[model samples]
Target: MPIDLSLLDDDQRIAATAPRGPVCILAGAGTGKTRTITYRIAHLIDQGAVSPNKVLAVTFTQRAAGEMRDRLRAMGAVGVQACTFHAAAMRQLRYFWPQVAGDLPWRLLDNKFPLVARAARAAGLSTGKDMVRDLLGEIEWAKSSVIGADEYPQRVAEQRRTPPADADKVAAAYRLYEESKSSPDGMLLDFDDLLLHIAGALENAPAVAEEFRAQYHSFVVDEYQDVTPLQQRVLEGWLGQRDDLTVVGDANQTIYSFTGATPDYLLNFSRTYEHATVVKLQRDYRSTPQITELANTVIGKAVGRAAGTRLHLEGMRPAGPAPTYHSYDDEPTEAREVAAAIRGLIADGVPAREIAVLYRINAQSAALESALADAGIVYQVRGGEGFFHRPEIKEAIAALVRAARRDDLPEDPVAVARAAFAPLGLTRNVPEGAQARERWQTLSALVDLISDIVAGKEAASLVDVLRSLRQRAEAKQAPAVDGVTLASLHAAKGLEWDAVFLVGLVENTLPISYAVKAGTEEIEEERRLFYVGVTRAREHLHLSWALARQEGGRKSRSRSRFLDGIAPDLEVESSPQRLKRARTCRVCGTPLETPADKALARHQSCEPDYNEDAYLALKAWRLETAREAQRPAFMVFSDASLMAITEAMPATPAELLDVPGVGPMKVEAFGPGVLETLAPFRSG
Candidate 1:
């Protein structure tokens, strides 16, 4: 059936009118931006003005690419080249090599860590596995950013003067790595090199560039804000002076700067093309009005970042539940409360698969996961290996090493790891024993040793060595049952769930302490990450934080600053349910009859100064929580619960449960005590 696009408003109609040149859609959240852009592609094909192969669509993630392709296919498009900047580059490089770069034979390092570790050992880096792994990340980040040996000092930004492996040595190893790739039987082309080679293909050989230009004369990019410098450069090289670019993105959503992406590409697209069609979408299709209003309030504070990004939820259902802010007294309590919320949401109709519990660091999810289990909410982590232990890694590593040798390792190891280990377990080694521990420890040491070697230099027999390691690891593999996914926010990219619970919304995590604004480019990239997290939600979205943890530990944290970036109309907050600051009458120990409080407003003139204990209680709770435990409480239960109870005066345990947030568990726990403490019913 044809889509009732007539229902689409004017801006959408403009977006649908197959753009002739550069079309920039500065769409806000829920504005049907993706739908409009997808329809535009379908329409172009429908009009027979563009062949499927002639149109190239670029997205930031494989999932996004898949989604675009699926949408186009549904609308009758076939054979469109829809893929990530990296994927597209690789696809083109696969065939254009002989024509452009003289048939250079370079093997790709699909999983560079192991190979790098082997190389590190060959280069002689004596370190623990954890340290080696960290080092590999640094080296990979350097490579990804195109920071060469000569630019090491200027680019690394780390404090070490003499690197663990000296600059000379590291550079020497990188040269070896390059040589390994350039060699006939060598293997190792990192994703960074994909862009490099494509750039070379376009810049070095005019024929290759001309062929691509002739074949793909028009382009469409989704989530354009997340495009990297290399990607942008490649697109420019391919498109040359032609303008047939339709770019859609929201600048206010810029949150992925940590990965070297930028929203400026989308923000300044209009300026980049003089004859561009620019459109702004304010009709959000995701969140409810209550949610939108809170989201709007949060982002409204953003002072002049993006000109046209507006998150309007006026068109969605009036509201669902106002985003509740739950400030806990402690960490465990917070986790427990969050679990309960997940349970309640599930009971209220959210499927187990619909909910996601996200946090800043990988560590935070442990407690939340435990709490969710305790609550019996069937959950699967979005990231992290739930089962597969060292043995599992070795098997995958062995297979991967073998595949790389055969040029058969798929594009993503993470994907392969996921598929292979769906049946593995973490306790594959054995029950506790000194010998068992030693063998595991030795495997750990080897993994560490290999990582150190890989992060340093190139090595030989990498395939054979990994195969042996795999055999050793396989001897102790275990199979796992079902569980929620556990992942870092970075790993959670290009994914969505029915309900997303952003656990560590604290200041340092979502914006991430390491996320820095080195320049205008970096700052814009950071904003794009915020957009990524927000747009990932297909339905329910929960942002949580703790006021404190276990008594005397790290202080509980605040909500993610990204939450502050949302447009107020999005209503990202259910704050009355999360936070409360109520004045009380000293004479009667009753809440103040303030103008905002309907029931108490009549007695406003006679209200007395509230007891200071309430505020003290809040402060005391925040100070006494275990940072971890406190985090969950603040995530689920709000100060409003206590205040609402204190003011409403539920005289009995049953009546107590009648309060919106009160449940049977609370009645069995605090009901008797709270009911006994309500002095007298002093009517307002």
Candidate 2:
């Protein structure tokens, strides 16, 4: 039976039906981008345009790939291969290793931390564990960008990145690590080496490359904006000049630039393929109109190169309560209020699991977690020791992976999984406590996936099943357990919850003090990070900042300047003390019903005591002046500038140029209009 295409929106339908060339789907948050990709796959198979077996779908994480496969199966589009970049490369390398070279080198090392530590010690560097970890991370990053140890210093310098204090020592350690990897008796390939080797093989071996491309006729990539340059090169090698590709991502959410991922590829997709079909999915079904507006307004300030024609999202959902903003006297008060709000939300029928508390840095979680615990609320740190990384779970998976290597294909992979976990006190029978039950459920889900793959003929061997499980584990994709989630903004990417508490919106937190000094790129990424956090909310969003915090001692702080960048009309601020007077529209003296109403009124009514007509006239003149100058209206004179102009009633060009954001350059251009616009409000 063919799947129904009627469910998709018109733009989505167009994206799904774009024929066989480079297609870029600019999907915003909650725009059903996933649905479009899955439907496109189903359509390709159902329409006999491409065999399900010949389609290769790639996602950033194993969890995403698994979800895609599940969705495809539901749509009756079976046999499609969905996997992460590393998984795909590993499979190809494993299958063609013999033909390309001789036997494969040493087995894949699961953890490189210990090896790195050993290398550091071998290099006579007695660094702390944290320093060693940082060194190892730098090495991994260098490798991911295809930079070898020899080229590390030069690349670091060119990028303007500060070299490690002990740069030579770290480099020596890195070289030692590389030598250990290529030892005569053994050699090890880490996760990134999988992509690096596969790309190299395809580049050098034309026959292998041709055969691989011929085998997989169609390609679909999810989260394309988070792809690194090396990954893009791999995709190019896989395509081999064939434009049978569909890439979907949001450029505005490109917060992983630090990890070598760039949104340039996604943003420039049309430029790369002149004939590529580009479609924008703007209808956001997740957030309220107020929330969507705030998201759009926040990202609009992004001056980064990747910030293209602001793809503003149109909210399809009904308007909800305006996102609340709060200012606290101290960090403890902020945490307490956030906790109280969570309790209130749960009391109001929002599930605890549906609520999440997000912060800019992991350190901020300490207070929030403490507050939640005091309130008897169960919460899980999103990226901290996920289900697949749990000690017991890792042991069980190791046993299952070993069993999968044996030619004996078990009828019930779930049963094998059960046996593997039995030693760890995890079994098919019901577990005792809530936590145990959850763990058992996660294991059962993993086994069920393997069983389904086997039953559906998606796996040709037990090894393949093992490989799939291992890949998913490495990808850190775990089932969503029932608990309030606490995560850093970076870890919360590609995930959402009902109510989000964006705590720690203070100055040194959001834009972060280090990012402020780092330069424009860092600041831009920080803004993108804030955008990611805001868009994660499907319903209620609360942004909060503390005026003071007590770590060593009470220190005064202010709200982030990024918050200041958000259009004045998007947020309303509040504190413990209620407003002494009723908030009324300054223009008409009407009571403001809500924060959204107040924000709108504030934007509309600048300088309430002054002549209203003068403010309006000044705004009109500023708009016209901006249009004439081919600049944003704010450049001509900010709303604040207009408000000042209306109040001061600057009659002369010199006085008009004295207004904020107006300089000598402005006096040569729009100063006369500024004076003329102010004349109506000026008393002769």
Candidate 3:
């Protein structure tokens, strides 16, 4: 079948049919880069310029490689090789290892943590899990950048890297790790080693390099912006001075610099191959105009090399709702209110699966998970285990169950639960380090669950509280297939949703403290990350931040500086403008003078006629209803709604619906109970 050029835009068509020496496609977010590249390969095959068997397509992930193969096959272009850099290198290494080393291929190291811990022990360094993980990360960075143990310290200084430990200690650990891997008894090869070994083999072994180079005549590399130095060396070996290559990437999406990946290769492609065909894909088909506009605005503020080459995405879709900005008093309030807004969207007919709540870090998911569960909304965590399935949470639950089985339980279930998690390092102050902080957040969420359970019950026993927890755990075990997605921004890349909530957009969290300290380049990467998060929304985009980490804590946090030009009318507590807009009475429009008036949003003289008995009765009913439903009391009815009910004394369902705060959904849910609560106080 002849390749159809009609399917592609003008730029895509030009890129697909361009002369095949060297081609570069700068694909922005939502651009049809994948389709363009696939069609380009098919077009080349159809034109008899390249054989399908000799074309190798390399991407960043197994999933992406699989998708590429599937698309090529669907387009009637089969026999093309599509795989990740490691996968491609591993195949060649496996074939040549017997000839080169006179032994079976080394067993691939599945988990590096154990090996890293052993290396740490050998080096006389800390063997804690966090330290081990950090050490492994540093080692991987060093190896992937093609820097050996001896050169690690110098490279760290040159790159301005903040090592997990002292530079000398990290170098020692890296040395030990390499020595252990190369020992006679220990034949282990990690993912990075696969590339390093192959690159070396091609450079040293002429027969192996000749055979590998002869196997492929053309190459297509996706996500070229993420190519690390080691991967680039491997690619060069495969090319063997040939320029038959096409690379596709977007510099704005280069968020993995810390992992040794760089956009320099993509940015400097033309410098290496002077005759390369360069094409830019800027038309975005994923999001609406409003979303793309915000995306452009966010990226427009970015500076530095990657940002200088950024593509300004042009949305092809119709206009959508403008992105919203929200400010909350505290983190818990932000989570709860965001959950409430999600529930409202679902009620408005948006599929739960079409929504997402993206945060800056993995630890931020705990509070959001609790809030969604309390709102009776189902959510699945991406790139990590579900809240209940987390190891720490499971351990806490097991401890609680064992304690409940004991006969010497305290009257306060909260006390029992707290004591159960105390051994797990549950404390008022959050611990330092990434792993410890995540553990603390998970345990803190469990404690908060206990408090909510006890608050809802009249006189809850340990057994009853444990049962409720067990029920909640069970519910969280198998989340609904179509549940809201809770993911960190990094995990949310390459995916989009109808409604996206970019929560926890405070300074220390989004740009992050480390990025702030790392200087301008890292800060620019964070800004690009923010741009990535903004583009994930197809229609509704909500960006929110909190004034404080916890309730009653100091309101010292500020919104991310990236939002300075994008979000309108952002008012922090300390802002003089915020102070100027004083609290006012709802009825009289007069500035409130006292704390009582501010709390009530009205002056005492402007207060409506009160009925204490009716108000108390309604409040009791709301509490009982919320307890039975296992929901927050505010979800059932806010205090303002209860006050409106008390003042109106609505006797019928229609009259109850007439209350300002009451809507059709509320009337359908609790109308009869509300009417009965106000029956005796009716004037009629």
Candidate 4:
């Protein structure tokens, strides 16, 4: 369906329909930046201002590019090239490889770490994998910043940047790396080379560059604030003096500076393109008023010109409960409490899939993962291997691909899938462990997806479907499963959840000890990270910190300064002692075991919290439904299940099923009455 321009807000309409020359959108967190970019592409196509094939949209990641393509395709503007900077450059380089750098027979080195390690060894460096990785990172930073071998030391000294331990060894390794790449025997280029080579070609080879400029006459750059010097060089090369470009970014979210990305490109876009149309998008639709306020508060305290001006978010959603702040005894206790909170929410009817637990670093996930497992609440880690990459799942995928190649199998892909996996013993010889069970669930999901795709298509063949499936499998794509998400703050960018727990908000954790020592700029980046985590919540936001480490022998820590920046009015603060016993009944002085207990414990005639009334109503309905069905009340609805229902207050049967324990069986049995009990609260 064609997008109706009238549906957009005033700012969005201006962003989407701006005169098509140089444009810059200062989009804040959750301001529908993606929507604006997609709409701008659609608007241009709809207005016949640019052909679909003539436009190019560049994103930071392949996943983001895929999302952009899906959005543009949905808006009926197909054929626009949406891809990463590296991908676009690689395509152009490959097409012009025969013309520019002849017969070198170069191949892109996807993993540069091994090469760096090799060069380090050649340089006689006695370093561990971690140290080598750091050196490789410095190398990447140097390359992206356009720093060459001769200028490496001068650049580091000029910027007051601390060189890696074994600085001399690292420099030697860098020299070796450059030599190896320039040698005839090692005709390999790193990811940075993809942009550098293409930009070099454009700068030196005008004919080849002009051909591309003419081919992609218009452009859109997403996340422009993270563009490095090399990326900007390529963008400039492609733009060549044309003003048909749109850049969308948030300067406050410039968190990738370690990799040489600077906010200068976005901050100076107006100065560069003298007549650039700048639009500020402040309407945050992804977070509650409380969350938006907290984010604004964090960013407001940021120092330096890069902080830009803090844009106060005009929240699009209604007022939600005040954001919760919790202080825990230790990391384990924190993880356990977070897990319990997640469980309570799910039982109250919030879908497990709608909740997320975010942390400052990857190490924090281990304790949380263990706690969630002990609680029997399923969860998927964002950057971990995940269920799709499990050994059993990988084996099943390989078997299916082998089966797909057989000429004797049925032409329909679904039939081929059945024939392939049934004999693989995925269902018959189920594993006994939790990880194995998760893998089994992953396999079942893949089979269902294939069946659904082939069900209505008469012409679908095994080969074509297998090809698509294989591509997705290779991409490490995991099908959606019912589970809470655990992700690092960096990984949680561009994603939001209904309930978000920002865990490990201690002094050294959020700003990190390293950032504290690095000076002002690094501390500012840490605040930006906190700002990012704060904005990734829609309705509920819970911020937590551990007083001590879970591992023995650590001193007690203070709360992060970033947390101190948040206004007290915007959060409901509690210490470990308070959160543990805070729910005791006011009149009876009894510690309520559950939301249901608290509801029933309240003085009958006295005024109570609205949630208590809703919980009482849900419990009554669940008991009656269980009695009528001749089932145990627990089977009809577990306390956790009932709690989730009460809290979520789902209005429809489908929404009711989103609560973790309300699977198809429960939904079929008790959904109508559940909806009835929730209808009044849902309206409120």
Candidate 5:
């Protein structure tokens, strides 16, 4: 059978037909790398270079592996083993464990959290959920980086990692975790241990290595940039000393560094195998010219190992609309406006499913979910549940339903809901850790929904709110599968849409504050992440950022640095410029002399002489009002507004409206209580 080269581009054809010892295809995003790799496998088989059964193709995901197999089958190249590294390792381990280890293999531990908790107890560390999750992440990173328990502390320091616990404790927990896996009561092997055991087996047993090498004569690794050190060791073990290998990846798409994946192997492939055929596939067929240019610019600024090998993608598609930039006063405004834009795009004949809103983190979805719901738009969150289907939201809804059935039901449904949710960890301050913050955001969204419901219909009871929630959830789960997509940027990789709304582009969120602290390599990875998000767009690309976390908060945030060089008409302030700016007193219009004055934005003498009693009363009233309305207390009236009112002693409606944060709508909603609270402290 003749393998056709007619369908491949020049670069692709070259990569597909390259002579077989060691080949590295530097395939940029949307460059048809998969097709080229499959073609190469078929060509190898057709050329009689390797038997189909003796060729092994490995990728990062099971779906990708399946697709590779499917493609190979379509090309008349069957019997080749296509699977993930873990799958291949597990298969080999299953077959050879009895012969090598003198007994049947241990049960594979599907979830490591329970065992991690046990390990934490043995190590005298905190067993909190977030702590355990972080520790598990650390242990996995250490294992993937090929660092042993004894070396974990030094590695943590070298890597400048902010571990969940002290380095010694984390290492202790890791050691205990390893010990527990082999204990008499606990005969378990985790996913990481699979690769380790297999590598160890091959290293210790020459006969096993010989048999394994003889089993697979040729190998193809996809997404080679994401191969961890541990996976690399297993690959090395499998190869013995053979160099008949093909690795295809884009160094710019190397965004999984936190998972211990690195691009060193892919970048250094030619150096490692001096005669390896290195082919660069630069033409991007997924995005438009505007998008490709943006993607190139994003990665062009990267300054690290990946930068040296970054592929300058050429857009193969026709020119499209220039990417748009947006700035918002606050996050809610950003989400609302972005959702509105998505709705408008859908109205302009774009299919709802063809538009997506991507953000930096999972917690960012809660606001977008609310705004989309408010706009009467349907959406599905990719790589996660729709907002209503989240565990925290479901738990909150159940609690609300339980409260609705109470015999001593309060007049205010919001109060009943708050009292019910309080025990479940609903708080004013957002919790630490990604998992906990996401949970808090979900609960907070629920509270916001209840507020909206009650505000829309003053007569709505606790039962009515629950009914509304149920209706919303049902609507989301309806047969309309063409809803818009809401996803995190990381989740949006390898996915494309006609229109993309890249929201939450603020400095702290995108580069993310921690990435900034982690030094240049992490920052470069963040840049590549932005490039990945940008390349995900086919035509319409809308980038946006907000200046504040909440509606009335100070406009203190800056747009992501990745956007500084790309976005037009935007003057981004450098760190030095931002720091050098003077803080002036809001009351006197003069420079602040002290840190406290600067923080308060007012001098001591210029500060408003507010009535403390009246301010306290207003706070209490705000809390009760928030509970009754099923809203965050800050939404009722920020403490600043309360203080302003007490100081100004707003006696009439007009005066109350003059105070900051006290708008007409708020004055109309809770005016009576606010005025009443200030009455006792009024000056004669």
Candidate 6:
């Protein structure tokens, strides 16, 4: 059966078509973009606008691709081409490699470290294993920006403070990378090679390009703002001269600029397409009006940013509460207050899964999780308990030290290693072995020079040597971060949660321990960090920090600056003094009351045995649950929510989240079990 486009509104109708020329759908989060793009592909197949084999749909995530496929079937269409950018590129490169490049190699490398290392060796530079990584990054960034080796200096000169050996360095490495991968020998493809190969195929083989252009005829890209030049070239090849293209993305959500993605692609949509249809999905269904306002305010005024060409959000939802503003004396206090709110919410019937805690860094989760437990909010931390155990961060750390000792450390490796060290209490002063000594030296050198490298530019002083190194060592692949929920700000992109809590908004944490001078690039990234944090919240949002915690009985701490801006009319309070039992009158044997109902209730007997541990535990739990919300936990509840659980004692699934701390998803995941467990005590 043919799919229906008539029922959709104007924006949706344009979104449904197997269009004639280029189309851009500038959608915000929760704007039915996936629906529109999926339906468009289904419509194309049903209308016989393009052959199924020729059609292509590139989404950011694999999960998105799967959902698009399911939606096509539901709409009575099947097997329209759809996949992630990586998956799509791999298919085309594999199919036409022989015709395009003559001979087939086993595979291409994504990391391209080997190529960088080889180039460094050829250049007569003395370096270590990790330099390969930097060279690859430099090449990838250059390639993404569509800057050829000849024109690299003028275009990126301002951007680079500590320049490498001009365009020749990257060009040389790129040539070596090409030789190693496409030399009819190896079978390994790193991430970027997939795109480069397909682009290579299109550029070299005119016939293959024509076939793809004629067959696919139409196109759609999700997160269009994130498209690199390589991706844009591939997209152009797919559509050819035809404007049968539709792109959906928000420049505001352009948080991936560091990865060589540019929102300029989205900004210049009109220039690329003969006729561009621009629409916005600004009517966000995910956040409340309060959250949306904050998002608009923060992003709308972002300075030194390119002006948005044409952007608007329609059909906004009704207003909600003013986002609660709070600032505590330190990380612990902030975490505790956030937990209290979660507890309060659970007590009011919200579920644990419905709340999320956000933060600026991965390292901040330690204090947050600790506080949640103290508050009895059993949250599942993102990626899990053994993050420092990650092979890559540690290896990179160790590798950086080896390289740094040899003067070959890269920024990413050093950053990874340094963050991992704070918790381990590891210091460079005590070098354990050759490996340790090498890593320690690298870290030691970096630490000494970091204050001056306030901007990431100065940090590039060690680039050439490091770039030559990581590229050479292919085995230095860092381990993947693992946890039930994510704990790092870097890993939280393109992801969302039912509830969000952002902890450690202080100047040093969110803005970070790195980046001392706080230049434009670093600050903008920080803003984007906050922007990402804000968008992750679907229903509820929280921001917090700690007052104090005893780590070896040292009580020195500072609160996050982000908390200071919003927490209006700050009130710092302490635990009220406990009543004295010895003040009873002799005639009535009553405790004298100075205030409320004191005279009437004074005759009641005094209770004994204060549960300090229980009270402190509850207090601690409140702070913990409010730092970040990145994962689903076992039993599907947060610790602060559990305190709410203990307090409310609901007897049924229907009554579970009604107890104040529960979230919608948590209720679905563990509502019944939690209810059953607590039902026995309801009668008591």
Best by lDDT: 3
Candidate with maximal TM-score: 5
Q: What is the lDDT of residue 230 in candidate 3?
A: 96
lDDT by residue (236-339, candidate 2, tens digit) is 88998799899999988888876678888898899899999999999998898989999998888889686664589898888898988887666666787888
Candidate 3, residue 198: how far the Cα is off, in Å: 1.0
Q: Output the lDDT of residue 544, model 6.
A: 59
Clashing pairs in 2: none
Question: For model 1, how does the per-residue alpha-carbon lDDT over 603-622 read when each residue is reduced to its tens digit?
Answer: 44554344334433433443
Residue clash pairs of candidate 3? none
* TM-scores for every candidate against the unseen true structure: 0.63, 0.69, 0.78, 0.69, 0.81, 0.64
Q: Model 2 Cα displacement at 607 (Å)?
A: 50
lDDT of 2: 0.76
Candidate 3, superposed: residue stretches over 4 Å from native: 395-471, 478-480, 570-684
Give the alpha carbon lDDT tens digit for every residue of 1-684 in model 6.
Answer: 767667555677766773545678877765667777777777777777776666677888887788887887688666577799889888878887778756646564545555667776775542354344455666667767776656766666656522334455656655665556543354566777677778877877788898777667667788888888788888776665667777888776676665678788788888866467666556676677777766665555555554444243332556655565555654445665777777777777767656666665444554455445556665654533322333434554464445455432224433433433433333423432223333343344333223223233434533433443333222222234321243566567767766677776655556654432437766666766777777776656666554333212122344544444445544532312212244553236656665432422233354312322332343344344333344333234554456556665566654553554354455665566565555445554
If the candidates were sorted by their TM-score against the true structure, best first, what order would they fall in? 5, 3, 4, 2, 6, 1
RMSD list, candidates in order? 18.8, 23.0, 14.4, 21.0, 7.9, 20.9
lDDT tens per residue, model 5, 571-618: 433323334447667677778889867645478677445455676788
Q: Point out the higher-scoring one by TM-score: 3 or 5.
A: 5
Kindly give the stretch of ten consecutive residues in candidate 1 with the minimal lDDT sum: 425-434
Summing lDDT over every window of 10 consecutive residues in candidate 3, give the lowest-scoring window: 427-436
Q: On a 0 to 100 scale, what is the lDDT of residue 273 in model 1?
A: 84
Q: Residues 577-627, candidate 3: write the lDDT tens digits.
A: 324456677778889999877656579788545776777788899999999
- Better by lDDT, candidate 4 or 2: 4
Q: Write the per-residue lDDT of candidate 4 for residues 1-684, one digit (tens) a residue.
A: 556989778998999999889999999999999999899999998988999999999999999999999998888998999999999999998998877888778898877777778888898974445456677888888899998877888888888777665566667888888777777654788888888889998888988888888899899999998999999999989988888999999889989988899998899989989999999999998888888888888888888976555567888899998888887666767888999999999988889899999887664665676568768787888866553455555676788678666665445565456545654433423333323333444565556556544653522876666665555444433336778998888899889899999998878677877678779999999999988888989998998887666433133577899877562422223443324344565446656667655656554544544486787787888788778888777777876677767767777775675565555555666788788778887677
Model 5 residue runs over 4 Å out of place are 374-376, 395-434, 437-474, 478-480, 550-554, 570-608, 611-684
Candidate 6 off by > 4 Å: 1-10, 17-19, 46-48, 110-136, 147-156, 161-189, 309-321, 336-349, 373-388, 392-484, 512-518, 546-684
